[model samples]
Target: MPATIRDVAKAAGVTIGTVSRALNNYSDVNCHTRERILRVAQELGYRPNQMARSLSSKHSKNIALVLSGFLEDTMLNDFETMLMKGIYQFAFEHGIDIAMYVINSRTQKEKSYEQLCYEHNIAGAILFGLKTNDPYCEALAASHRPCVTIDTEVRGPCISNVTLDDVTAFDELTQYLIDRGHRKIVLVHGRKNAMVSMERLVGAYQAFTRNGLTLTHDSIIYTNFLREEAVAGVGAYFRTHTPDSATAFLCMSDMLAIGTIEALKSLGYRVPDDYSVVGYDGLEVANYTDPKITTVDQNIKEKGYEAAHLLYDMLNGIRPAQKLVLPHTLVERESVKNLNELSN
Candidate 1:
């Protein structure tokens, strides 16, 4: 049989209320007593019944994670998947439960932030893929629930965010390509409203200006980050223009990069030999391509883990720093060749 709280209290020579306080991390209990109870509970393998505790405490001890796009959508990239894994792992460690709400046209309207909080008795929420003018963010802020956003920003008193430095990372990546003697680069980006896309575009432009290269409007392509969209976009471009028009292609995500490669092959154009490709989000898929894609490694899994812990801290009444920006690295691979070498 599993050990009970009462059993733990008796073993530790503490009152039932004291045991509860210690286990729940309530500050009312003395430090020495809390430590003693915790040690005793561990020795006896005492595990609190989470459901029962929630019922008694009137706090669900559960967090709601609202994903802004469908699982089948192109937005569900490696960054999203790894980030969710990190949230789950952190929540589990802290004895909290997570409920996921996948956002789509139907669910987005059906579920309101107020209704979700009231229905689930949620202690907090984590939002991924927030738009600059999203109504949900406004609602969440008004609800006054402790919330955290990953890869997006939200404005609220109790909300915090975790993200990468998109402009700097992208600028560095594009500059790397420029240094390799690649000119006439094509940029394939996501939705214009996405914060990341905007920041990346800024970085891309900075790279062009610094290198004294001209960035034409026609050189940029906007896609929904879908593999199909990437293929169709590149295919159409190649048909209307010449393969030699651009020496390298820059993709905002690995999924797009992979699609670009597929389309290039189908069109009988060789990667690196004919066109070099660079991708963001160094997903494992990047390495599997025929000529592996060069990309920026954003340490996605760690980002998730950190986001989870940050939210956990907020829930526990510990206000952590507002913005947590993780580091990024550029992974050099086969997809991009030094045009200088070709010139020489």
Candidate 2:
């Protein structure tokens, strides 16, 4: 076993308290006793407990990245992986200790947001995947600690929100379809109480209205942001309303688009030729299909980077806290067809 503080104290012929004070460089300890403790600690290969040490300090340097999903599901997705990479990179570069915690909606019923922070000894937090109905969201708004929420529209006095313009992105996407002569488009969306979903719905409506087209309420399908759920939900949806129901499917996520393609294929349909598709989030898997999906690259990694920066700045008092919107680009691939040319 590695050396503990007890081992060092024994070797140095001092109490554990004296050994701890000497190792932590407390001034009250005599210089001779501190030197002896440190030398004995080195000889015994004693390393301080980081978690214990953090708890002891008044100003803990530890922060947490609060992700909202099961640990397995969170790591499996490309968006989450890329986001974590950006967050971890920032923490590493800044000499910050980052703790990762997953608190799904169900877990929030048992533990409050503040309780999680308290248990983890977190000084600040970067949160992601909180929907509108989360119970902790109310507490989060009232929190005095530094926090940055990623990709959500929720606002608070101290909480910084990092996201791209979801409304504008979806607006341009719908307009892109309308420009290409694609009318009667189906909008595949995420769950209810999702702020982003609401924003995207607004964008789609705005685009359709501006072009003198009506986006009827029946045209939207809610799938709750999972591929398997999307597959079953979309499959059942189109079964009731045939492929001719819409010429294109404008999905709020790549997973939804991919699932739509699968659901359509199982019913003996081809993408773009039979029904055009456009997805949000530029995931690599979206490109693996026979016809690559057109998508919006919303800079998810940069959102993580900005979230870290925002929370750190708030904690350090380096800058005032506010919403940070990052840039996004539309990637046009082989998914959406040019219906105008076909009409000619």
Best by lDDT: 2
Q: Model 2 segments beyond 4 Å from truth?
A: 1-59, 71-75
Residue 35 lDDT, candidate 1, scale 0-100: 59
Put down candidate 2 lDDT per residue, 79-164, tens digits, no spaces: 88789888988988987778888889888765667556654666789988888888768878877778998877566778888888
* TM-score against native, each model: 0.80, 0.82
What are the Cα lDDT values of the candidates? 0.80, 0.82
Q: Runs in model 1 with CA error above 4 Å?
A: 1-59, 72-76
Q: By TM-score, how accurate is candidate 1?
A: 0.80
Which candidate tops TM-score? 2
